[model samples]
Target chain A: MNDPVAFVSAMKAIGAGLAMVSAIGAGIGVGIAALGGVQAMGRNPDAAPLIQTNMILGMAFAEAVAIYALAVALIIIFAA
Target chain B: MSEVETKKRRFGFKRWIVLALIALGVYTAFLGPTIFRPISPVVVLPPEGTGLEIFGFPITNTILGTLIADLVVILLGLSAYRFHKSGQIVPSGVYNFFEVIVQFLWNTVEGAAGNKWGKRIFPVVATIFLLIFVANLSKLIPGYESFGQIKELHHGVGYAPVKLFTIGSLNVYTIDKGQPVEAGHADEEHAASDDKSAAYSVAAYAEGGDELCHSCEVVPFLRGAATDLNFPLALAISTVFLVQVFGVWALGPAYFEKFFQIRALVRGGILGSVNFVVGLLELILEFAKVLSFSFRLFGNIFAGTLLLSILGALTAVLIPVGLYFFEIFFGIIQAYVFFLLATMFISIALVSHHAEEHH
Candidate 1:
């Protein structure tokens, strides 16, 4: 039960799983942005394309945070 | 209206038959056998192009992909040159397509750099965008990830290649004549002792059995170049290096002052100390940008390919198609993001501190 190799592997797997938890934050953030965009669109429809471009750009920035977490998870699994 | 409706109705039966045949053909060719007995798609984080040796130099599948990308760039360049030499004022066909893309890229650089630095920086930004875009989309080609040299592994011997081919294979004459070959039995004994898995060392295919082990394999070709860490890392390093050079060219010794802040450290006031520390942090962040840039592109593309292969394995029907389209969209977006980030970074470096403060 206390074997070192097995313990290390388990820890790595746990760390990777934990890293993925960041996606929840990113998901919520992007969802809120989209909701705001939808509400704004309802108020004024002429700014649709402008709103969409900004929304996508913002979502990409948000997604990059998640991607960074993924990179960390990958490093733990592969590099370690 | 009646005539048009009659004409449309006339081809309906034939069109449906053709569509059905195509659907059936696609099913059998790609996903039919895998449905009955699913195959686990090989998904490794790091690029492991089949370990092919050529004149003792290791050649990876990513290198092959990069070579193909270079060929494409060359072809595009050659045609553009030909079009220029032809002196055609009005372009058509492929040249027109090239003109539109180049014009769009130029507009982007011009937007970022204004009229001044756009011409100077246009080549690098446009080339990176084109290269990455093509490399990303290349994965969408049919049999892109599927076709490759498959390797068979031995269980106990632990990755003993049963059958393999490389550029070295073509130089069999040199290998035979240049070096004295050792005894087979002696070599086998040496290898077995090195691995030390004698208990499980039953020759899985000793009796001239099938060369390929069903499960243990490696594909040596057609992986997207951007999915490999080396390509993106190299690109990031070059971009960061060039950005710094551009900063120096634009601002001369003043650019170095932003990074070093020797004057701030010497002054030793509270603001000066803070500014100096921030300068150091900025220097560190510059290096960090390379890490973020390389990993972002590599991780996204690699994960995308893995997602696709997994999807194909898990389903026989329409689910994978949706993901395929998603990947296509993502490839374009990533290229655009990389382009924008690069241009922004360069432009940031080129702009002076006073100019920023004024704005």
Candidate 2:
């Protein structure tokens, strides 16, 4: 049988791996948000010009948070 | 009763036929998860040259896709329209939809570049938007991307070809665990095939690799065009550069003041730190803006393409059928947003040194 402490640590590593998978959620969220803005711009031609710049800005902020989460997960995986 | 029946009969057949065809196209191709058969990429390995040869690196498919998108747009504008018009109805429903697309683009550029300059950039922005949008949507087409033969190394394995044209045969190659690589193989092949053939090392197969890999088996053939950073990054640079070009055109030598407004703050004194910091922030923001623009489009489109592909492959029929329409809508919107934001950045960059507006 594997040592309890080592098994516990390995399980922690596995948990970290699963946490990194959260990037997938972030990915889906980001894509949906972007599509929502894109759809809005398509419907209203006049508003699109002004809204698009803001849309990109909003997209980047969302993506940045996701990326930061990814970075943390990566650190945990490597450090562990 | 007679008049009503006649009117319904006149239009019924044509509308149903068109809808049926659209439905058929979706069911067969966009049946995502159910489609076990592989699709081919719209742009494939170059039979000739690639951009991967600078110091010998793998040139990504995204760059190749961008090049193809640019060419396709040129050909499209020069030759055929996506939707036909004329005596039928003059700007059919599709045409009106696209006219709206153009208007959306115009509003974007005009809003960013202002009414005066927006009109000037409308054509360029629209072309870029439409071309990229179409290229993205093209990924949904079935049989568009497929695997091909194991390609030989060029001056070695470092450089990869860009455009890939699916050939009659897709030969699978595998590298057996132990095999020898022959030097001067091109010469060796010349002798074996009467000196007219290109040499391919069976070494990879010798170690154990499948023969016909779809543009590097790890990545799917039907990839979204914007997934790789190269296209968006190159576009960001071009857009930002154009902003400077217009700045010089409009403000002459004084354009330098936009970046270095050191003179404006001499009278303000101690708040000079704030001015200096803001100036640095602007400088940093320029690059950050480029990074954001590239990553935003690349990440969003790529993730969508990847999910649709994965989901479509799993379910095959119904689920993917619905997503195709959304993808079409998405393609147009993303392109417009990208172009609009670019126009906005450029216009902001070109503002006069003496402008009254203070942020």
Candidate 3:
């Protein structure tokens, strides 16, 4: 409590941890995307390749949110 | 019956080999004096200086890694070219390997974009994938992020360096997992007096005995190229730049309309104003694309390298092997993701907004 330096470091650590909570949204988004893709593929197996490709694209977009969170977390830890 | 017997025999032999390997791995994990007690990897965000200068510019380890990846790509290209130039009807070896990858990528691109546009985009997207794939996978090579020059540690916490061996005049050193030398009273005094602004002490080195060499840490000669933000940022910038170029080349002056929909705002009333706002958002999203692309690749590979190092430091044997295989799969998937995204972006840019409205 006395050391301002330690207190700032602790705050940065906590901030970084909080930043990563955004990844939960990304995880759920990706899972839902996959679920839809799988069902579509099952319903129409012939369109599976196209569906798979689009599915991956959707997943990547979903995952980008988490990547942003990771970037923020990293910046908080290392640069801030 | 004979064919079935042969299949069973082969399966039995493979299973025994796998079992023996597992047993050997377990034994090494448990019994062997841990040869690779990697000093809780110093997670230096910025690439470490190699102390080598080219015309006074300091060379960083990530630059070295980038060069290595470039060299590998060049070699692969040359080898594949040589094999092709041989005019062999059926390709073998390296050319065959590249052929499968190229064919698969080409098909995907063609499927997404028409054949004409796919041809134009394929080379750029494929090259990015190959380069990123090489860079990501190169980190798994034995010496990377491990072997390096020993330097005096400037921080509070650092591992003690053990002299591995000597060759002629140079002494090889590696960090031992023994007691880490803490920041001494001198460092604390330095921190308290001179460097109150910074959280950590800016002291030159920690105090330690000659035998332990606790003040030393290794600055690795090569790190994963993508681990550095600059590499991915450079790639993302160029990719985005190329997307704009492709857009302009395909749509001429109409490409700018995608970003600025002034005509829509002037004529279409409420809906036109909405279109203008949407266009502005699209323009903003282009910039966001760069951030997402670079960060996605960098975060994945950097996290992967960190995971492997931490896991290796923790459990030096069987566990890391599984993780290494996982990393390999993850690396390829990341490379594919990057390629797929670039292809999609370029393909999207090729289409006019008006064309999409009609469809």
Model 3 scores a TM of 0.87
Error of 2 at B18 (Å): 16
Across residues B1-359, which tens digit of lDDT does each residue of candidate 1 receive?
Answer: 99988888878978898678768756664645422322335565456656668998777778778878888877777879999999988887777877888887777778777768878787888888888888898868876766554343332122222333334323110011111223344355556674664433435333223233322344646789987889888988988898898889899989988888778789788988898888999999788778777877887888888888777656635677788899999898888777767877787788886556448
Candidate 2, residues A9-66, lDDT tens digits: the string is: 6777787677667677767777877797889888987887456577665665566555
> Model 3, B1-359: lDDT tens per residue?
99999999999999999888877766655555443444567787888888789999989999999999999888888878898688778888877887888898899899988899999988899999999999999988988988787665766676656667766545566765564666464345444675563433222122221222345577888999999999888889989999999999999999989989998888888999999999999999999889999999999998888899888777765788899999899889989999999999999999998878768
User: What's the count of clashing pairs in each model shown?
Assistant: 0, 39, 0
Ranking by DockQ: 3, 1, 2
Ranking by TM-score: 3, 1, 2
For model 2 chain B, give the 10-residue run with minimal summed lDDT. Answer: B154-163
Over 4 Å off, model 2: A1-80, B1-64, B79-103, B147-223, B357-359
Q: Candidate 3 local accuracy as lDDT?
A: 0.84
Best by lDDT: 3
Report lDDT per candidate.
0.71, 0.58, 0.84
Alpha-carbon deviation at B167 in model 1, angstroms: 20
Model 3, runs deviating above 4 Å: B1-36, B183-213
lDDT of 2 at B137: 69
